[model samples]
Target: MYSPVQPMHIPDGFLSTLVSIVFWVISIVVLGYALKRVGKDLGERQMPLMGVLAAAIFAGQMLNFSVAGGTSGHLLGATLATILLGPWAAMIVMTSVASIQALIFQDGGLLALGANLFNMAVIGVMVSYFTYTSVQKLARGKAWGIFTGGALAAWTSIVIASLAAALQLALSGTSPANIAVPAMGGIHMIIGLGEGLITFGALAFLYATRRDLFHVGEAAPKGSKAIWVGGLAIAALLAVLSPLASTHPDGLEWVAGQKGFLEAARAPLYNLVPNYVFPGISNGSLATIVAGIIGVVLVFAVALGVAYLRRGRKRSK
Candidate 1:
């Protein structure tokens, strides 16, 4: 059976009810603040950028790469998004990505969405922003310094998110903190390197071409159309290639299996595009590709909508 690409997210049954509710409340509070902060500073050109970033992040998450011990990991994209679009905007983008994955693809448990959002979208983005900014300040904003900052920021974000997930699992009695933390943290340490390299490479590419995108809203950047087209094209390409992603179990799944809690995971309450395979598609690969493309479009649309709403709110105030 073909399994959809799954990230290192906690599935239902892995977390206790109280733990889940606590995270949900925390996530809601943080996201509410994010909306307010974003509304105050959202720019006209940012709508397209948000859409493109969300699409790219969603598509990128579908590509799982193999790691040690037969486990696999995928890009979290929190650091990359936070660096490109500020922490507030990045949180919104990450939320859209995680929510769509859970609701549409069933990649994550619906009940666990709150914890997932808190770990990856909220905490992850905030850590990235602060780390990257601190590094840039220390380096005095040199080119290498900025690139290094992005790389470090990306790595730090993944590790911290992993630790947070482990802590949650521990709190939920899914595993002991000592064991869960080391296991989760160790594996993600390697995974974070990949994220760091990817983030660094992306920053370098942007530095080489379309550097203006780094500070787009600060001034009117030319070739805006080309930037948008190129971004979407990249996302589409990733979606098409998603079928080739690693088939190995993801970090969380692997840990669950090893820790003897894999059986605890429950089935999704509903299914839309279950496991990224569109229904009625005879070919699994084709189904996944189509599903991924649809996901890209959906994420882009959601991000655009959020940006528009925030912009409208700003105007009204």
Candidate 2:
């Protein structure tokens, strides 16, 4: 059976029709609010950063690291996105990214788009933002506190997303809560470790490189050369290391297999690039690398287009 590498991107036929519709409605509403909230802080200067960061996020998701116990997990980047672009923008960026993954890449079910977006975008970003801010305040601005807060928030977001996915499955009668919860929660508990560490390390890099960055309404550092170089480096790394990613099923896939629902997944709306496989590419590794690059470029363009349009609207107003 086929499997996805991303977390909580529940394919079609897994969720009840009602559950899917509810999530879609909920996600759309949240996204509307997210746009308005983000508009307040997304100055023109921040637009380009969103595109580049979106690219980085897209690339990052392609590289799944092992979580041990025969499971794997990729970066959620929701918490990290919150740190970079703030919660609102992160939500928008993440949702857009997830949507593209579903539509063009065929990585997720179109009917299930709403649920996946809700779990990864709304829940992940919103919960992580609150957790990070609270921890930062409680820690009183120390580097350790701030960094630790990021780590905690990253881990929390992953765990919560996992639980939400489990809840969706349970509500759909796909699996028992007792079975889904522990399996998802336990596996993700370990997956969350990498999420936290990566989040903290990225934050530390930013702090060391540009302290004024990530503040509300603040633009990226004026010395942007380093940022560009870093972003490119990350994108390149994702392209290179992705094919080397653990072939083991990710946490969600592993759980589904154990729970016997892995076979329930259905074809996406379109398979333009099924499994992130690029058309006309026979070689598996090369296809994945090409697909990774394409995803980055596509994500960058989408983010830039949105930011550009948002700026245009503001100017018109």
Candidate 3:
């Protein structure tokens, strides 16, 4: 559920060094494109909210919910962020979250940074963008429709990314295609439900509070009961249920175990650090709580820093 690094769950050595290097290159190129687009689309006021939204997404990811059996799932929050901030900004936020998780928690391998970014940032953000847009058109801005669309889009993106990872593993000969793809896809399908529900509820609340925020061709709106109360309620639910999330191995782990690659999976070098526990922090319930706090702080800092830089550059120009 709440693996220390969250979304970038492909374990160390899952993909070969060569494959990982290629993913890194692809991720950088895509990220640069996303940033350029975001810099142009987002306005000054949106920056602060974007920072808060990033922190919220990071924190939400740490709150794992039990799926089927002993398996667990957590919110990607990409769908929610994209619905609020649009795809380009969502990519920046998600990439920052993934980067911090890798650097601070050592959960995702640096070598696979590009792969992770591509999966979570590019697919999650951009694909969801189109999906939600289609849904919004169909729903015609109805709250329920928008919420449903966002949820589905978020869920779909995760499944697609999972498939992509499976393909990489198969191509690398780390595992057979027959074994890896379906196994990963099956588990992630279950996980995607949780992601959808979370995204839906968050978006619904945001829309309720700041209806203006969702308006086409306008700056993101500020404040309302929906924002404050909805956010609090969601956070409370996460805190209460996070500890009960699934203990079983996730999609990647399940594939690795079944395909006989689990043994060959080398732990990242950085993971040798004392703090690099799979469960992270204390291996207790508090682990998620602590991780959530850390995630919130890290995302806030990174988002603010990015926003500040963008603003400074604009002012100079």
Residue 115 CA displacement from its true place in model 3, Å: 0.5
Tell me model 3's lDDT, rounded to 2 decimals: 0.68
Candidate 3: misplaced stretches above 4 Å? 5-8, 67-71, 216-317
lDDT of 3 by residue, 9-40 (tens): 56667777656777888778867876776676
Residue-level lDDT of model 2, residues 1-317, one tens digit each, is 33355546788898877678888998898788777766665698767877788778888876676767877666778888877776777888898788888887787789999999987887777667667766876876777866898899888777777777876776666766657766776777888998898888888998999988757334433323332343234334422332222232254345444543333343343354465454558677887899999999999999999999999999999
What lDDT score goes with residue 243 in model 2? 25
Q: Point out where model 1 deviates above 4 Å.
A: 1-7, 63-74, 216-317
Candidates 1 and 3 compared: the better one by TM-score is 1
Q: Looking at candidate 2, what is the lDDT of residue 313?
A: 100
TM-score for each predicted model, relative to the true structure: 0.65, 0.64, 0.64
lDDT of 1 by residue, 1-317 (tens): 33555446777889877678888998998788777767767887777888888999987766766767887666778888877777778888999888888888776778899999987887677667767766876887578876898999888777777777876786666776657767777887888998888788878998898776666325322332332343234334322322222122244344444543333343343353465464468577887898999999999999999999999999999
> Which whole-number lDDT from 0 to 100 does residue 108 have in model 2?
75
lDDT, each prediction: 0.72, 0.72, 0.68
Task: Report residue 206 deviation for candidate 1 (angstroms).
Answer: 0.8
RMSD of each: 18.1, 17.9, 17.3
What's the CA error at residue 14 for candidate 2, in Å? 0.4
Error of 2 at 223 (Å): 31
